[model samples]
Target: MTRCLRRIAALALVLCPLAAAAPAAAQDSAAAEALFNRGLADMEAGRYETGCEAIAESHRIEPKLGALFTLAICESRSGRIAAAFTHFGEYLAQVDQLTPEQKSRQGERPKVARQEHDKLARLVPELSLALPPGAPAGTVVKRDGRVVDSAALGAGVPAEPGEHVVSTQAPGGPVWETRIQLAQGEKKRVELQVKDTSAPPAGGLSGRRAAMVVAGGVGAAGLVIGGITGALTLGKKSVVEEHCGSGIGVSDETACDQAGMDAADSASTTGLVSTIGFGVGLAGLGAAAVLYLTEPTQREPTAGATSRRIRAGVLAAGPQGVVLGASGVW
Candidate 1:
């Protein structure tokens, strides 16, 4: 009698948990079925948001292929292209795992899912994000609050069409956030930049002022060279006069000796150099004036400032002749 009682108690202990769980299981199944029916009704009535929510819950509880299909269709109709595409793929994969009889019972669902998936492929938007050239090694990027994989950087990755907030964080850098709106079939490329706030405070010469100084220095150097060369040219004329007869009407080349010819050549060379120096001096001074006039009144770093460029060029008519030297700041 004692052994019989012990065996009966053990059996009762084992069966009690099963009996208790049966009601919970039944309730869950009933709830899942109710949610599934309600989801289908809501979807039929064009209430995609509510329908998708209910159907997603039902699928979570019961994991039916039909519920997944309904959720996918609901998401697609609601313009959640990425979600729909993923669910359709999942539905198709699960359908593939079913028995042949079960598969046949799926009717045209597999075919329809494939078509929808392929079609969504073209309608889905992609976001291509890349860090700038000098981004820190441990930079972290997030899209809509989800961490993005490192390997996907600079590559076109799938994204849902809608307003999205992208954020990035780097060591010793401020958290950068950008708002982007994507449309169907649109591919956007974005470069993530980390703003450096570590620059020295505004206490030194501004970039434009510094540029003006440099240009002015160049102009001064050119002017000094022109003046020096001009003097040398006059000295060469005196040398030519001394070598050749200084009579006012002496125009014949044969009257002058080889020394005079050499002196004349030297004078021509000095004159060319002097002209070139003057041209350079004027161009540099003009560039300096432009830079000074265009400079901002406040002393600020050039970072993030409006982009400006200075161009300088020498137009040469021949090897020894520079026709024009031009400079501009724009």
Candidate 2:
């Protein structure tokens, strides 16, 4: 009696967990059955798209061969013979597990699937692309902006019948491109050749050339500056001639003499500045021209304003203060 009681206790312990899980399993089976029935009803109601989706979902929840069969048939009828053929092959692999009764019931299934696979194979078009001999190594091929796997290049890739574009980089290297329209059951081949895109024409105005052009402008401006300073020097020389050269007799004349000496001193400084500016302008312009002719590539653009301040005109020396030359921008 003790052994019997122990056995009974172990049996109860085992059955308790099973009893608890029974409800959940039953609920899941009920849900799967509901989905399967819904799929069938949807197909009968002319909603094949929803029917196939539901059947696939049901198979996902509970992977039964019956649901797979239904999904495969639905896919084929919906004009996706490729998808149908794929599922059919999958089904045949495991269909042997079914009992004799199940096998007898699903007759002509394998035959129909084989026929569809062969037919879809013939109808699907393929595209083959080749990169020309000069194509850069590691060139990435793309289809409609999505990069193609390097492993798959130069091989026939199955594609839907439609227009397709093939292109590659455009700067520095050659531009390789082609646009193709594929027809059903067609095998198309495309080879892209690179066009020369490296060098500019022998003589083109570039950055260095542009700098030379600006240098030329600077030279002309420098010349103008020199010319203006030259005029100021001559004006100061004239002042000296009028006062000191003509002996000073009147009080105003004496003031003019002192002014003349100051002017002469200022003329020397201005003349030197003008000479330096003129020489710097000519030498700088010549150097820029040489660089423009010799540079391998155009230099970057220089952007800014240049300014110079020149104080030139003579001012009257007054009793209150000693006046400096004219002050302004040049």
List pairs with backbone clashes in candidate 1.
none
Query: Counting only residues 3 or more apart in sequence or on different chains, how many pairs clash (N, Cα, C under 3 Å) in candidate 1?
Result: 0
Model 2, range 216-306, lDDT digits (tens) per residue? 7776776677678878878877777666644456545445567777987888877776675566455445545555554443121111323
Q: What is the C-alpha RMSD of each candidate to the true structure, in Å?
A: 11.4, 17.5
- In lDDT terms, how accurate is model 1? 0.80
- Tens-place lDDT per residue, model 1, 104-214, is 999999999999999999999988888888877888899899999999998988789888888888876667777778889998887776545463345756556777788
Give lDDT: candidate 2, residue 116. 67
How accurate locally, in lDDT, is each candidate? 0.80, 0.68
TM for every model, in the order presented, reads 0.57, 0.41
The backbone clash count of each candidate, in order, is 0, 0
